[model samples]
Structure formats: structure tokens, C-alpha cells
Target: MTSLPLVFDAPKRALPPRHLADLDAAGRRAAVAELGLPAYRADQLARHYFGRLTADVDTMTDLPAAARGELAALLPPLVTPVLEQSCDGGATRKTLWRAHDGTRAESVLMGYPDRATVCVSSQAGCGMACPFCATGQGGLQRNLSTAEIVEQVRQAAAAARDGALGEPARLSNVVFMGMGEPLANYPRVIAAVRRITEAVPDGLGISARGVTVSTVGLVPAIDRLADEGLPVTLAVSLHTPDDELRDTLVPVNNRWKVDEVLAAARRYAQATGRRVSIEYALIRDVNDQPWRADLLGTVLRREIGARLVHVNLIPLNPTPGSRWDASPRRVQDEFVRRVQAAGVACTVRDTRGREIAAACGQLAATGA
Candidate 1:
């Protein structure tokens, strides 16, 4: 049996010092004013951070040298790169970032033919305690501040624009599918989502539809997010369709069963008119059975309907020495067929960055 960390249900730790991303336009002005700086400097700083995508204080030549130092001190850096590894001939890159308190998290940048996506962590470690997840095994370190979450996206966007992942491209998509259960750190994650999707000179300006926030069926959070008016996709990590198996795979299922989760997802889809993504990690002999796939398809179709739900069949990316392994291609194919046959849309996810410990918490674990 796995030993769960005591911090699983503990309250969130104190957030780190305020960073620029934590504030909106008005808040930025207030922050600058508090620092004895001109209010207009706030917009300049915002432009540098969000529009220019540069965090280096020395590069802000528009500001006076002394003012730049003072402004930089006010808006301190949130994430320091600890390690970065690339795979898929540089198309997929993973970065390990160390926060102010020394807690570490990771983010992944993947460049596809049409889109560049960055998967960012919302917490230093995860409390979900999903047995097969690297992040979950480590347990919760602490929730990341809104700025800490936003910094990951900023860094990834910079990398994408710099051609770090082949030809220069804009970061077109962001996914909260790294390190932690995003909805677990609800407020901060939502703020970060706003920061990512808001228009430029104010935020990253990425479209809300291009962003995805995944959770392990945090039902209340799902319902709350549906009302936020952000049409970002909601991905429920439903590794198994049955409550009994799901209870073991996603411990949160103990509180809200499979049906409750799918119901909440249905509400979200109906509210946003965006199809909910059902994430099913196909662990060999665990939750990859054909019958389970059939159940998954039936339940999703019955609850959320075919138009409002899509299944993303993930091949389990086993951690080092983990008991879990990916289901064979034969099994995986059959599972996809079963779900599709039930009149549901399903596709195998394009796995990436496994060789470089791209999965959340893997880099931090190895570093520790």
C-alpha cells in the first residue's frame, strides 16, 4: 500500500511575496504608487512583462537606471529555472523551476505543426495522490501564487517566440496539466488563467478557448469555473468510469463519485458550450479494460452527451520503478474502438517528453 502524505488535506501554505502577475492594471498602479513610483510606470512595467515578455531588469532601457532597479525590486522574479531538458528533436521542452521558498515545479512546452502549447504547474506539488502520477506520489508541497503560475506561461511563451522549439511561433495554447490539480488551488489558478487569456499590455492575450484547466473531478470547482465566463476547456481526469476503480485511481472520487463528476462536467459544457475533455490514462491491467472503456463512453454520452464531451486516451507514462505501465497498443486500440463504437469521440493523446521527465514532479523528484 502507498503511504500518503499528511499534507494531503492540509490548508494551503502562505503565498510568496507579491509579483507583478498577481495584480491587474489597477492593482499594478496601486503597487507602483505604494513604491513611491509614478503611476504611469505601472503600464510600462506591464508592457515589459506581458507585451515584451522580458523579465530581465537590465533590458528595460526605457526606464531610468535607478527607477528600473526600484521597479524590479518591487516586481521580483517568481520563477528561477533550475533545469531544462528537451526531446523530440527540440520540439518538446520541459523546464524545472524553483520558487522563492525553494519549492520546485515543472512546465512543458510542445510545438506542433499548427499550435504551440505550454503545460504549466499551478502548485509546487500535488495533493491529488493519484497512485500512478509522479506529482501525486510526492504529495502537496504548497500552492503556487498566481504570479508563480503565470511566470511559467510567460517563460514558455518567450521560448516559443525565440524559436527555442524550432521556427519561431507564438504560444497558442496553455494547459494546467502539470505538477498539481489546478482546481485544488482554485483562486490562484483562476487568476493565472485570467492573466494568460486577457488581452496584451494587460495579460498574455491568449484566447480563453485555447487554454485548458484540468482537474481530478473537483466537482465544486468545476461548477464554479463554469460560471466564471471563461470558456477555457475543462478536462476531467477520469482514469476509470466506475466509482470503485476511480476511488482508488483518483482518491477525490471517494467524496464525489464518477456520476457526480460527469454531471458537473455536463453543467460546465452546457454553460460554456465547450466540449469537456475526459482524460483517461490507460494503465495496463488497471483502468484500460475494454468494459471500462465501454462504461466510460456510455456514461459520458449519457451524462454529458456526445457533442459536449471528448475522450483523450492517454497512454500511461509510468514513473521510475512504478508498478503502472502503459497498456499495449492492442489493448489501447480496442479501448479507443469501444469508446468510439458507443457513439463518442475518442483519440489517443500524442505523448511527449517522457524521456526527459516531462511529467510534472519528475524533474523536481530527480533533483531532490
Candidate 2:
């Protein structure tokens, strides 16, 4: 077995000041008390930020003028919009955000007839170093603070309510699949998840089951999330089925291997009773062979069982100047056929925002 080097250090950068979204109810009360305001003020702040989805102190009319400003100063803004691009007739919008530290990250909002989903980044640039991905090729910038992550959702939720994506609909789903390896920023991502799923006046009130947290097979983090008792869906980006190829496609495969990742995913499925999502990007002639598809079906069924897993076949959205491209339609159909033939559920994922570079593996926000 060949050893693969792992790099976990994100560039040391100053994170933004703590915001109201970062702290829980208790912490928020403590923070308010420290500012010489009554602890009950924390609940008012929470109602404005989480329930009203407004961070502007002026909109919080229930609070006294002086107290509102003092509390707002303590929370501090985290995300500043750098650029926003929309496609699919304004049904899909991608926003590039510059954090207070000047690190850039992207969050995408996509609206379907039934639900609206936002894809958010947990880190600025990714450290995973997946050769085919635009974000991974850029290298790590820094982990996003919990408040920074939650702010993206708040903005998206507000956008949805404001009819930014067609009719006024609720932002119902969130996927941590934008620019970075989510589990690498474990603690903050978990905290953000709580803030996203908690009920109104405390957090975004999005259902935990509607949230999906993706990883490039971060084994330990997957196990840790399983123990957290939050029933968010787990998505493993297993670009290839065999270890030999996965080690090259998803470099983290070199550390945990394909078997280890599937086992951890199986444990997550059993613990959460939620079907694990296997994300396979079908790059042209790269790990898209018929045999690889067969192997994918075999291994998934063997390790995680057919009932507990579903494969999300992603048609590769090639980055600019990258040799990688999407597989041919016939090839993609055959691959799906093979996986389904193995008695495991599989479907081609709906590709969106390609014109605005918001598709899978295209979210590189370093320059935005």
C-alpha cells in the first residue's frame, strides 16, 4: 500500500467577532448580561435574528434604542456579499460572500416546485486537494465560524421569503456541499447545524432531516456526527468504488480507504435510520467504467446494505481548463443501470446553475 500525505492545517487567519448566531440561548443570555443589559434582552435579540430573520437593530422595535444598538454591536455582522449570480430563470442563485477576515466562500440557493435548498460552505478554500474539483485545487484558506455558516442560511431563508426564487417559499433544505470538506471543520459545522435546525426564536427552525452534511470520507467525523444524535443525512463523496481509484479521485481515501468509509456510513445509517447518500461524480473516462459501476453496487450492498443506501450519480460539471468532463449520456445511463441492477436505489441528480458556475465541483470562491 502506498502512503498518501494528509494536510489538515488551514492558513491561520483572523475570524470575525462572535455573532448572535454563533451562541446558544444560554451563551446569548450570558453575552447580553456581560454588556450590562438584562438577560431577557437575549430572547428579544433571538426573535429578531432567528424568527424575523432580520439582523438590523432598527427593525427590532420592541427593544429600547440604546439596548438595541449595544446588543447589535456585540453580535457583529459576519458575511458581506461580494457577488451574486443567478441562472435557470432566477430559480437558482449563487452568492459569493467575503467573510470579515476577507476569506471568500459561496452559498447557493435552488428552488424546486416542492422545496428550496441552499448549499453552503463550511470552509473558505478546501484542504481536501481533490484534483478534479475547483475548490479543492485552490487549497485551504480558513474554516468559517459557526456564525458565518449560519448567516448564509439566514440570507437564503430571507431570499426565499422575499420571492427571490420565484414564488415565496420556505428554504426547506440545506446541504454543506459548496466549497469545502465540511467535517474537517467539525465543531463549528455541528454548531451551525444546531443553529440551522433549532425552532424559531432560537435558530433557523429548519428540520434536521432536511439538512445534509457531506464529506470526502472523513471517517472519525462521520462517527462523531452519528453520536451527536442529530438525524441529518450523511453524504459520502465516494467518487470511485475501488480503493485503488478512490485513493486518486478522493485523496482522503488513502487514509481511511473505501471499506472504512462505507463502514462508517453504515454505522451512521443504522444509528440515524436515515439512508446514506453516496455521491459519485461521473468524470469522463475516469472511474466511470462499467466495471467500476458494478463494483460500486457490490461494495455498497455488501457494506451498507441495499436498504440503507442510495447513490446520487452526479454528472460532472467540469471546471474551466480541467481535463475532467462529464461522462457520455449512454455511459451515465449504463452506470445507473448497473447500480440499480444490484438491488440498490440509484438516481441521476438534477444538475443546476451550470451557466453561473454553481454546479457540483464548480464552487471556487477564492477570487469572488
Candidate 3:
């Protein structure tokens, strides 16, 4: 079993009141017993929340009516929706959530012909200070609680079930590519992942293989996550290949360097036997030069190898008033051609909800 460390690892932040989603089976039973309930009530509560996808205690019919309110204490609402916007004819939806502390975060739910995926936020804002990211510019607010992260998935699953994105379908995947660097808020994010992928009545029960966690190449965290033995996919935001340019682009590259980050990603891939994803946001003429593309391909080909990795090129979703802009389509196409030409797999990411600010931190940065 992947162990969960103490709640919020970041300094001095108050831990949110314990929600059932924050606890393990043993912890849940103890919480229930503290409320003067029987041990069986814990499983019953889990069924309603995880299996039935209902958070309203009144709807948990199997539990005694008298105890419903008491059980409800364990289900304190963690994420409250502020605004929801849909584009692509309602096939893509973005939600802004306000935490109890008034800090805000955002998540995006996108439905495709074959699957539905929700991009969830692990923090209210980011501290990475990546020049192009809205959240990074806004600065870090605080890390979200485990339950706060899990609630976004639960609601998205319910929305998909009710056909929020056209015909009803299972929410097939969850990506930690929303507002925050997921690996920075490591413990609660891992706890939330377990809650998402563990079997029903205990969790949302989505396949571990379907979850992807994105980070700006936090090397130690990458190595630590590799030891957890979970099958979740790892995505390293490597925007550029050379250390000199990456230092200005990713910012965190100054600390870990490009080679160190890629080496850590290689180790993670070897440990899990999964292809690591290298995320490159293609900026117009900034990091989009043909030679840089070639360097990106060569570096990955040497560091991560051909079969062990894939590069996902994001047509840069430029933030408001930012100097950054996405590369031209022709340039983007050529970049992919050059990368693939080096014998490593590369593909352009499908940009959904661009008009509605679907990119990470955009919606929440609106204070919507």
C-alpha cells in the first residue's frame, strides 16, 4: 500500500478539518466511533460517497435517519463552485472553486468521442513563478486539502454521469494539470490519487493507469514517487531542452537543471515500466525554433530513450496581457515532425476550452 504522510506538508498552513475522504478505512472507523456510531456505518458512508456518488447525507437511505446529520459531519463541503463555463458545444466545461479560506482554484472537464477527463488542481495558486503561467504569476495561496482535491473528481464524475458533457459516460481519466504543481503538494495529492483509483466504497475506483500527474520536474519528488509503486503516469513539464533557455522558461530549471530532471524522469520510467510524458508548451518564436526542436528530440532520445517516453506539445495558451503567444500552426507541425524525425514519439495536445480559459490557472485567476 502507498502510505500517506501527514496532511499538508507545506509550512504553517492550517490543516482543513478531517473529511472522510482524508482518512483511510481505519481512520474513518475511528472518526465514526468518535461520533458514537457503529464501525459498520463507516463502510455505509463510503458506499454513498464513492459508489453511489452522493454526498448529501439525507440520501444515504440505509443509515438510520437519526444518525444522518451526525454522519453528515464527516462530509463537510470542501470545494464550492463559483462559476462554470462550457464551450465546444458544452462538450468542455471549466469550473472555478473557492475554498473556505477564500483562496480559489480551477478544474476543467473535457469529453471526447472515446473518453471523459477532468483536470484537477492540487493547490489554490502556484509558487513555481513560471513566467507564462497565470497561477504562478498570481503567487501561491495555499495547498488544498486531500478532500478538497477529491471533491473536484467526485463532482466531475457526477457531472459526466448526468450528461453535463453531452451523452452520459463514465469520467475515464483525471489529470493533475490544473492550477498547481501537483508534486509540490505531494502528500495530499498522493492521498487523493489513492482515493480516486482505489476500489469503490473505498474510492472513486478509476483505474490507476488512467490518472496522470504533472510536475515541473521536481527531481526528488519524482524519485520518491517512483518508490511508491503506483501505476499513475508521470508528466514532466520540460518546455525546453537546454539548461540555459529552460532556466528562463521553466524557472525551476535553475535548481534541478535540464539533464538532472530528465535523468530523474528516466529513472521513474524504468522503475514503473511506463512511458514518461515530456510536456513542452510551444511558444511563438520563443522556444519554437527548429533547432531547439531538434535539440529537444536529441536530448530525450539520449536521456529517456525512444520507446520509454513521449513528448506532448502544448500550443501555448498565452495568459492575459502576457508577451507570450502560441507558435504558428506551421511551426507547431514542423516541431512535431522534427521531434518524431529523431525516432521519439511526439504529438500535439488537443487544446480544449481555449475561448473559455481552459488552461490551468486562467479561470481561477479571473477570481470568478
lDDT per residue (tens digit) for residues 246-266 in model 1: 899999999889999999999
Q: Candidate 3: list runs displaced more than 4 Å.
A: 1-11
**Which 10-residue span in candidate 1 carries the lowest summed lDDT?**
1-10
TM-score of each: 0.96, 0.97, 0.97
Better of 1 and 2 by TM-score: 2
TM-score, structure 3 vs. true:
0.97
Say which prediction, candidate 2 or candidate 3, comes out ahead on lDDT. 3
Q: Which is the better candidate, 1 or 3, if ranked by TM-score?
A: 3
Candidate 1, position 49, lDDT: 92
What is each predicted model's overall lDDT from 0 to 1? 0.89, 0.90, 0.90
| Ten residues in sequence with the least summed lDDT for candidate 3 | 1-10
Q: Kindly list the per-residue Cα lDDT of model 2 for residues 223-279, writing each as its tens digit.
A: 889999899999999999888888888888878999999999999999999999999
